[model samples]
Each structure stands twice: as C-alpha cells, then as structure tokens.
Target: MSTSGSKDMSRRHVLGALAALPTLPILPVLFGASVARADDAPPPLPSWNDGPTKQAILDFIHATTDPSSKDFVPAEERIATFDQDGTLWVEQPIYTQIIYCLARVPVLAKANPHLAKVEPFRTVLTGDFEKIAKLSLRDFETIAVATLTGMDVEAFAAEVKAWIAEARDHRWKKLYTELTYQPMQEVLAFFRANGFKTFIVTGGGQDFVRVYSQRVYGIPPEQVVGSALGTKFGYDKAGRPFLTKEPKLLLNDDNAGKPEGIHLEIGRRPHAAFGNSTGDRQMLEYAKAGDGARLSMIVLHDDASREYAYGPARGLPDTRVGRFPQELDDEAKKGGWFIISMKDDWKRIFAFE
Candidate 1:
C-alpha cells in the first residue's frame, strides 16, 4: 500500500482498539511550559533548609519590616550595631590589634630600654607567648597607651594605616585587612537592604578601627565607636588646628563598657545587634530591650575548618580581664538571641583571593 493508505489503516486500527476498551472520562494535558514555570519558582527564603533558628530570624525581620504588619518598626528607629573583633573579623590566636601593639614593642624598646624590661613588652620582645598571655589587663593597657602616646591624631592614623597595609594574620596567611568574614559582609549588606543603619561597636581602639572601617566594612568613621584614648585639641607651630593624643581618658569598650560606648556614640538604642563573644552580651541585651521590634544575633566561632576556634583566655592575674566563653554560653541559654554557627551557616569564611 501507498504511504497515505498505510497511515489510514494504522489510524483505523488505533480507533478500533480504543473502541474495544471501556469508555473513560477525558483528562486535561499540562504543557511542558506550564510545568516548567511551576517547577522553576524559587523556594521561600526562610524555608530553604535554614532550620528553626534561621526561620525565626527571618520571620521576625519580615514582621517588623512589613508596613501593613502590626509589628512594623519605623525606618528611623532601624539602627543595627555590630561588635568588631571576633564578630566581624578574626580574633583568635591573638587579636589583630594586639599584634599591631606587639609589633611596636621592638621600635619602642629601641628608644626606651625600660619597655624592654617591662613584663608585657619583655614577653612580647622575646616571643614568650605564655608570659604575654599572662600579663594583666592593666599592664596590657599601659603598654598600649605607651605605644600610642606622643603621636598626634593625624600621625597616629597614618601609622595605623601603614601597619594595616603590612600586617598579616598569622593563621590566615593574608593581611589583617583581608581577614574580614565574607558571610558577615553579606549580613551587613542585608541590613542595609532592610533599611537598617549600621555601626561598629568594638573594644579595639576606635581611632585604629575607624582608619579603615569605612573602606572595609561600609561603616563611616563617625559611626565607628570603641575604646579611645584621651585627645587634646591644639594648634601646630604654624597655628593650624590639630588634635593630639594624650595619656588619659581611656575608654575601654569591653564587657559592661559596651553599653556605655553605644550610649555615648550613637545616642540611640539599636533595633538590631550582631556580635561574636561574651564581650558583646551587654550590647545584645541593650539592643533587645529597645522599644520596638529588635533582633540580637551572635556569630559563634564554631567553624574550626574554615577559621580558628577560641574561647576566653585566662588573662594575667592583676587587671580587670573581660569574661569570655562560659559567659557566651550563659547568653545563649538566656534565649531571645540568634546564634549563628559559622560552620553551618556560612558557605565561605573570608573573601577568596
């Protein structure tokens, strides 16, 4: 048979076969295009394997941000505070700031042999980790002040800039400037996207952190608040206005002092707060107690594979040493806080080379 006659025979056979079977209701066919559209839809953010903790955070944020919601917070009150050291960057092994101070000891010792003989500086010069770790907070502060003294504010800023440019984190094999958490960077962006103004509240020297914070963390100099040495407003030999460093007014932005620093610098309570250690417990509490919807988050340094792990170290016997890990656990059990496990929550640590 010709091709058309053969096709006609095949159709007749198919019709005869269907006719032999029992009659059934017709069903609608779904097109590939429509099926694809349904399958390609993005999953809801808080539902995508984030667990209960992350879901609660997303729900809280959504509740506060939705204008029609009863829990909506005004944009003007959306201040977010962040603790710097272990919160945004690495503080394990040794703090980056302490490394900077220790680096200055050799130079300072050359000019003043008395520093070479001092407990902390002596420990630092001879690379005695045990002794360095044992120095009292008062002794450490004395060394910090001595190293920071004499230079004018502008000169001190320049020195910090230069030091940052050259200093590398011993564990990361990258400059201290490059040790910022990639995940936290995304969180900062997320806050900005959510109409929150951010500030870095830290225990490190404010002037030191402010030197590069804006470029590194997107926070402006005026928004960076931390421990500060006393400054003297003065004029140079040519009568130009200048600010000089003095050996007084040490505002240590650690432990209980964090709340005081926040009150002094931002002048308003924050609606959201992020931090990484027990040093930040009070700041988180202060943020959580604000009049409106608030979020308090702690970045737990649990990712040993990606970053170094540390608990609070026992400091030297004499000074007011800040509390560490056990306190962190207490804060966690206190509840109403978001605990972010770095290993579980972050896909990456620092920015890639």
Candidate 2:
C-alpha cells in the first residue's frame, strides 16, 4: 500500500438513519443513470455479498426510509454512530495506538531518562510486548500519557500523521490503514448516500482518530467524537495561540461515556449504532432507546482465516483491549440486534488483499 494509505489506518489502539421528505420524489432522479438502471442494478451493499446479515441491513434501511411506513424517519434526524477500533478497523493482539505508544517511549525516554527505568516503559524499551501486555492498566496509562501528551494539538496531529505514514503492522507487514474492513467501508458509504449523517464515536483519542478519519473513513473531523485528554490553551513565543495536550483525562468515551459523548458532541441520540466489543454496549443500548425506527448491530470477529476471531460469543482469545464478553452477546440477541459474522457475511476483508 502507499504510504498515505497505510498511515490512514494507523491507530493507537484505544480503543444512523432515516428520513423521508418531499425530496423523496426527486431522490431517484438525483442519481441519474444509477437510478435509471435501478431494477437491473446491483445491491448498494456490494461488499456484503448475499446473506442474511446483508438482508437485515437492507430491510432496516428500507423500513426506516420508506415514506409510507410508520417507521419512516426524517432525513435530518437520521443520526448514526459507530464505534471505532474493532468496529471500523481491527483491534487485535493489541490496539494499534498501543503499538505507536510503545514505539514512542524510546524517543520520549531519550529526553526523560527516568522513563527508561519505569516498569512498563522499561518493559517497552526492552521490546518485550508480552511483558508490556501483562502490566496493569495504570502502567499503560503512564505510557500513553508520556508519549501522547506535552505537545501542541497541531504538532501532535502531524506527528501521528507522520508515524502512520511510516508505521507497518508487525504481522501483516502492510500499512495499518490498509487493513480497514471493506464491507464496513461500503456500509459507511451506503448510509451517507441515503441521507444519513454518520459519526465515529470511539474510545481512541480525539486528536488521534481525527488525523485520518476523513481520509480513511470518509467521516469528517466535526463528525468524529472520541476520548480526549485535557488540553491547555496558551500562546507560544511567537504569540501564536495553540492547544497543548495535557496529561489529564477529559472524557473516556467508552461504555457509559459513549452515550455521554454522543449527547455532548453530536447533541442527538443516534438512530443507528454499530460496535464490536463490550465497550460499545452502552452506545448500542442508547441507539435502541431512541424513539424512532432504529438499528443496532455488532460485528463479530468470527473469521480466523481472513481476520482475527475473538468475541463475547465465539470461543476465541480473551483480550483486555477489545473484550467481547458473554453479556454483550446475550444483550444483542435479546435486543434483536444483528450480529454480523465476519467469516460468513463478508466475501472479502480488506480492499487490497
């Protein structure tokens, strides 16, 4: 993959809906030839191949969008939120951002020599991830703070962008962004095409995910909401005002925080929500709680061949990063939400290979 392409998916692993209106009459004509050939045209979710999972998505969109249906929602109220990490891309072995942090410790430690002797930093400096992984959450927090803070927002973003351009996944040997799931990309485009506003709600840092969200996921910066650290606004020597990242937690944006971020950032409850792990449980529940036609779905990583498989459902690796516990599975089933099986539903994984 090209450098930009790969950089687009690099992450530090942290890690809607409906309407109908008078515009409906001209909706078909809006696409010109694509509309003219509607009957003979292929499915909008082309990446889905043909399956029950795909059909469920189609049915939900149809029911919520049809003007005649009581379930029809207005275009303006069609807000859809998606969890990043395991939902949009991958969060296996560990979060990509953690890999970035590990790589950064050595650089940062050069200036702050004490970090080299720190527990997790000491382990990270030795390049022993197995040991690093065994460290407590507090240790990981220390590492994240050390490498990710102390820089101005613009500089930090540029640094992350630069790292993404150069970083390659250890296992795939491909650019991290190159690993974005193809079917989900199609789903994103599909929602946007149908007049829904899509927002990315993730636990990853706001500054981190915003760097490439537009380029990689077609979601703009304003539409991207995520966990953020406190930032201090000040002027540099040149009197240029800037926001410097602080080693303080601003918002978590995971579990219960997901709904809080959506309400605070997006201001509207999502009409549809998609996620892949336990961190997403509250967001799914929030979407389903909205009073109109709604959709809630979770992507199950069940395809070990094309991708990693671990879940709250499938007997797979138990992970601290993206845990899919049993309760999440039971909730999804009880709520009548769709559980997308990556192994069975998707014909392809990545857009490349």
Candidate 3:
C-alpha cells in the first residue's frame, strides 16, 4: 500500500474504535442548550459544572466578545498563553523532564566516569533524591549541559521523540503522552473556537516543545515560546545546513524570565493565561495587567486519584518548587484569575481510549 493509503487506513481503524465507544455529550451542543431565547447564543463552556466560577467565566467571555457590551475587547487582542508542565501536563513524583534525565544518568555514567562522581547525577543514578536535592544551582547546570551536549539539534530531537515513545510514567505504567489532562484539551479547543490565538509559554526547552506540541497540545512550533540553548548554524562539506551546539547562552524560562520571554517572542501581551505554581506568577500578572478584557487561571494539582498530587511545595533536588497557598487565596479574592481544582473541576483527567 502507498504511504498515504496506509495512513488513511490507520485513521479509519482509530475512528472505528472510537465510534464503538459510548457517546459523550458534545460540548458545543450542550452550551447551545442553555439558551432560552431562540435567537440567543449560550456561553462557550456550558458543559462545565454550573457555579459562580463557571458563570464568571461565561460572563467574561460574553462581555468581552459582544461589541454592544461595555467590556468589548478587540479580536486582535485575544491572545491566550499557557504553561505546559504541571498545568497541561503531569509533573508529580518529579518533573517529567527530570525523570527523563535521571533515567539517562546511568547511560552517561557508562561513558563518562566523571558523571558517576558528580553530586546530583551520582545521587540520581543511585535513586538517592534526598542527596540530589543538596546540589547547588551551578552543580545542576553542570549536569544538564554535560548530559545534553555534543548532539546536533535534529539528532537531539529524534532522541527525545524516541525516549517519549519508550518511556512510561514510573507509577502509572502508561506512556507519558497518556498522562495529559483531558479538560485542558477541551479548554484549548474552546479558546480556538472563540477566536483566540493560543501560545505555550513554558520553562521547558523550546526545541523540545516544538518537536511534539503540534501533535500533543495542538499548538504549533511557531506558537511555542520557552527556554533555549544557543545554537550556531553551519554547513558541513556537503553544504547541508546544520545546527551546532553551543557551550553557552542557555536561557532559563522560569519565574521573572516568563514575562521577558513572552515580551520577546510573542510581542503583544496575552489577554488570557493559564499556569500552575509560582513560576507562572509573572506571566499571569503580565496577562492580567493588560488593558481590556483579560482572564488568568491557575491549575491546582489536588487530584491524587486521577493524577499525582505533590505540592504544598516540597523542595526537589537542584530545583525549588513553588508553594502558593496564600497567593492562591489572594488571587481568588482579586477576581481577575480563576483557580481550577483538578479534583473538582474535571470530570475526566485523561483522554478517552
């Protein structure tokens, strides 16, 4: 069979399996059901549980979209940003990337005896997280650069792709791809339906996000803005362009850097933002501070059954996790932001099989 024919057949098989499953209520249709007047349109997210918070979201979307409404916001200004780790993806037990790095330490140890003697990498190889946490920021950076060095950009991307294909969550025994939040997927679609351009502003590697985000998050490579390592463009003897790794210019996209990265890459301020943890505070602040209609949301990892819950901020080896109980309360009182409880808000956590 031709490649296209094989692809078509594969899609048909997947769709056929999906069709055999029980039908779930369509979100847009459910939203339309809430309107009493024949000519009136209901809110974009009617399937969401009804409450003051849900109503506030609906009212904000409507007030901002309707030209006749006092709070009308222009279509050009409808940019939304989202943080990836812990917000859209699972990051418990440990950050997913850190887990990936830990898995790789033994492999590196075989080639470089120096890694076996190092503080964090040594602790990582031994699964001694308590000792790993004692390493300084510089020590962490050394391990990261050493582990990530020497590979061309394309080779590195392929390695990540392969790793993801084989890697399962330690506790769940499911592919890392399977751990994404189902409700957030709907939220992404909902924003797209409302004429909002979505961008990912994450602390994860920019190139790493670009490789799989289109398939995973429906956010394209051009729409992803994140931390970056400098690369030099060069050509070999055959004159094929290649990206060479650099020893320097690594930009970390956490905390205050979030706002700077957004300003530099996205240019315009986002009107809507979603994140989890204190790393996102600056980005949320920047989005909320924008003039006109704006909304910011934080995803609280309170659901332990569906996902791993590991907050109240435990200090991780080489990284400081944000604990924001007081800040979350303050943001709630301010009314500009929404705190989504993963336990209560989501009816389902992962996508239907």
Candidate 4:
C-alpha cells in the first residue's frame, strides 16, 4: 500500500478502537458551585465555570478520592499527565523550541561562520518564514541537532532557561511564560489538591522542558517526560562526570510515544490525562484504559480571537505545528472524552492583561 494509504488505515483503526470505548455519563453534581469558602471567594478551579465540562472533572475527582466510593483510587495511584506545547502554552505560529533554534542561529553563525550559508540556518537568518514553514520534519530535526547538541546538560539547560526568560510571544508581546492558560493552571492545581500527581509528557526535548517546568507549571523536572537526544557520559581532567548532549535521537515522546513515555517514566497508568492535539491521542487512550475511573480530556482551541485557531474543523485552518485533526474530535465524542472548548469553557486564556 502507499504511505498515505497506510496512514489513513492506521487513523481509521485508531478511531474505530476509540469509538468502541464506553463514554462515562456526566454525574449530577453541582460541585463547582458548592466549593465557595465562607468569605464567598472562588473555588480552586475558579476559571472553570459551573458547566458540564467542569462538573465532569469534579465528579471524577469526588468519585475517585472518596473512601466510600467504588471508584476510590489510592493517592499514590492517582497520576495525571498533560501535554505541554499546545495544551499548556501557546504553540501557534511555530513551536517554542523552533523559535529558540531560530534565535540561536545568529550566535552560532557568528562563531562557526560556515553555518551562515547553510540551508536551514541561511533561510532562518533571512527571516523567510514561508521557506521555514515549508521545511520537512527532517529539516527541523537537522536544526534541532545543530542548536541543541554538543553542550553538557547543565549548560544546555542554562541556555534554555535564559532563552525562555527573554522570549516573547509575537502576538501578545508578553513573555511566553506569561501566555499560559489561566484555566489550565487552575486545572493543574486542582488535580494536585485532589491527590493526583501531575506530569508533563511533551514532544519537546526533556532537557528543554525541565528548565522551566517547575517554575511555569508547578511540575517538577522529575515529573516531566519528553523527547530526547542521546547523551554521552564524560569526565573532565578533574574527573568530574557530566552528560553531554548528542545530536542523535534517544526517544521521541509524541503520538504513540506518549504512552510509552508514561509507562517507562511513571511506571503506572494515569487516572487522568489532558492534551489538545492529535499527538496526544495515545496518551489519552492510555489514561482512559486504566482499570478504574479515568478522565481523559482534550483542549479545543476554538477561540480564534483570544488565541489562534487551527484545526481540521469547520472554518479552521489546517495547521502543521499543532494540528488537531477532526478524527480526534470524532473519537473524543465517541469515546466520551471531555472536549474543553476554549471559546465556551475558558473564562480567561492568559494571565496577562
């Protein structure tokens, strides 16, 4: 069969399997409205209004956490995983890692000189986005290797930290860290408060995500599982050992790799999982496939005005960076996975004004 034919068949198989899973019924609990303190202050998931989507989470937690409930899960067993790129932060226009690579080119070219005339670097330097956007996956991986490798882990992490600190989103003009969804922040905290351990499973480099995962999302470095390049253990003249980043890929925590990452790193099935794009389908499936009560949700980027909208849905552009295929939505609907529509569900998108 042709490559495209094989992919279409694979997608159909996945969608069929997902459609077979039973959708959990929405529980009749007004948990969101009832969580106000004596001072009439907002609840933990304040950004989530009293709606079916928010109530579903409340019900899931209540059922799984209450000792008398049949669905009661032990605290240690309550694991929750999230996708970082489009799910936790803005990933439109280009991936933040790609942006970082583009920014590093000039400095790298200044040192290497020859890299200034290279295909990817030369195009990136000229700011020809159309050319950059047309680059194949192999081309992106080439850029990743050039900019991300050769340094010790600590040095690479420091560079990533510095870049993250200064990098601003082109649309909002705020720092990228400032562009996290307010509702998702609440969701992270809410899950933690409910005895669920939250983790970020992303397609971005583990080393890069580790630099700011704790500060940005309140998730520790140990809780992050992501794509990685190979590393080499070496010692200096003083005999201090360090791990140097190698250009070759060790793992890619995306698509089917997500569930593999969760299993390999966390060593347990998640009680809940959240993501926004088709890359997250396998992770969501892994979460929902757990023995007991599970909550798997997808964040629908429907609010084009507040944030960029691109999906294989009505009137939405077909985006390559963070594409949300229509089949994923169909599977979500079929499988009873909650779809968190940014337009309908989130009261706020960014923490910034």
**Count of residue pairs whose backbone atoms collide, per candidate:** 1, 14, 1, 0
Candidate 4 lands at a TM-score of 0.87
Error of 2 at 265 (Å): 0.2
Task: Highest lDDT: give the candidate number.
Answer: 4
Give the local distance difference test score of model 1: 0.73
- Candidate 3 stretches with Cα past 4 Å from truth are 1-47, 109-120, 127-136, 310-322
**Global lDDT of each candidate:** 0.73, 0.81, 0.72, 0.83
Q: Summarize candidate 1's per-residue lDDT along 21-67 as a digit string, tens digits.
A: 67654311322443343334332331123665455555666666677
- Models ranked on lDDT: 4, 2, 1, 3
Better of 1 and 2 by TM-score: 2
Cα lDDT tens digits for candidate 4, 1-353: 01112223444575567457665343214322322221143355667666889888877877787777799898888899999988999999888888998888888999999997888788878887888888888888778888899989999899889889998977888888888898899888878877889999999988998999999999999999999888999998899999999988778899999999888899988889999998999999888988878999999888899997888765578987787888888899888899998888888888774
Compared with the true structure, what per-residue lDDT tens digits does model 3 show for residues 1-353?
Answer: 11112223444575567568777676337534332222243334433565655555555566666667686777777788999988888876666776666666788899888878867677777777787767777876776676565668888788778888789986778888778887777678767766678899888877877878888889999999898888988888999999976656567788888888988888888888889888898899888887777888888777667775545532212224544455554764585688877777776778742
Runs off by more than 4 Å, candidate 1: 1-49, 110-122, 311-327
Estimate the Cα RMSD of every predicted model relative to the unseen true structure.
13.2, 9.4, 10.4, 12.3
**TM-scores for all predictions:** 0.78, 0.87, 0.78, 0.87
Clashes of 4: 0
Q: Which ranges in model 2 have alpha carbons more than 4 Å from their true place?
A: 1-42
Per-residue lDDT of 219 in model 4: 98
User: What does the lDDT come to for candidate 2?
Assistant: 0.81
